[model samples]
Target: MRRESPHAGPLRALFRQFSAFAGVGLVAAVAHYGALIGLVEGAGASPVPATLAGYVLGGVVSYALNRRYAFDSDRPHREATWRFATVAGVGFVLTGLFMGLFNGRLGLPYLPAQVLTTGVVLLWSFSANRFWTFRP
Candidate 1:
């Protein structure tokens, strides 16, 4: 049998976790953008409020999925939920700021601004959740 590298197992595990995280994030993004679009287009709601609502829905979906799949933490639901909400709360503020800057101040389209904001928030979520919210 061939010898495997010492670092391979941990690397593979990390990759798997990241893949799961990304998958969950994709689902969350669908929820977020769907609500945003529906509220803004169908209900004629303003972008900021619509985005906030969408983020809340998406944050719920993300917390459930990430806790179960991505991080696979055995932490109690109460603790994990509180930690996840804290991170998400900060993320929401950042999202609003970025969206306001990109869409409102910069005069970019809402869709593009939201897309950019999502990317930025994705990084923040992954880092914060990995380090604090779902720490192993």
Candidate 2:
């Protein structure tokens, strides 16, 4: 076997993987926060309820994109949905925490909180989906 460079192989691979996952996550977050803002401000839904609805929609979009594009998980549909839900539940907690900080404490408003929390939870969500939810 050829000797690998000290900081080339794994590091480069990790960077590429991170880039791709981050890209997909960005799209999913857009779907989530878009729905959230629309539901809350436009529809006059409560902040918490709007966030929950957004989470559900985001979870669905996230599973579809991440499975086919991000991790390429090919497991059966039912099993995959179960795993996806389990992973998403963790992200939901993180989302809620940051949202509470903004909406409850900081009073920064809904859209800003949603954007910030999406960034905070992106890495965690990607890792959980890759290692746990989509793993063989």
Candidate 3:
């Protein structure tokens, strides 16, 4: 057994960062799903496009919250914003690809597919944002 201290500095920091990030993600997800459901059920938009739109809305929210809340980054906006967008662009593509696979091909319902997609994207987004977008 290789047990280690519970309060190890780096490990604890990572856990705290991820916890804050997940909290912000929840708020961002509301914006995302709100747009998705509204467009799909109310406006008759297809799930894919609706979700894409929602992803954009959520990305904006995520960036705003995550910079300070999750990462406590002191990076200037001029630099950080572009890095954030770059990471988000990759996430957007992943979102579309996974959504298509899950819903369009696998025949899962749109909401379920979105939930899966969110989990996948969350890992990518957190890593990229932590290492690149908001690095201190």
* Residue 131 of model 1, lDDT score: 83
| Sliding window of 10 residues with minimal summed lDDT for model 1 | 127-136
Residues 1-136 of candidate 2 have per-residue lDDT tens digits of 9987898988997677678777777787777778888998899987766886788787887788777777777788888888888778888888888888888789988777777877778878878777888876
Give the Cα error of residue 77 in candidate 1, in Å.
1.0
Local lDDT at 12 for model 1: 99
- Against the true structure, what is each candidate's TM-score? 0.92, 0.84, 0.95
Q: Point to the candidate with the largest TM-score.
A: 3
- Angstrom error of the Cα, residue 1, model 1: value is 12
Clashes of each: 0, 0, 0
State, as a TM-score between 0 and 1, how close model 3 is to the true structure.
0.95
RMSD of every candidate to native, in Å, equals 1.7, 2.9, 2.3
Query: Number of the top candidate by lDDT?
Result: 3
Which pairs clash (backbone N, Cα, C closer than 3 Å) in model 1? none
Name the runs in model 2 displaced over 4 angstroms.
1-4
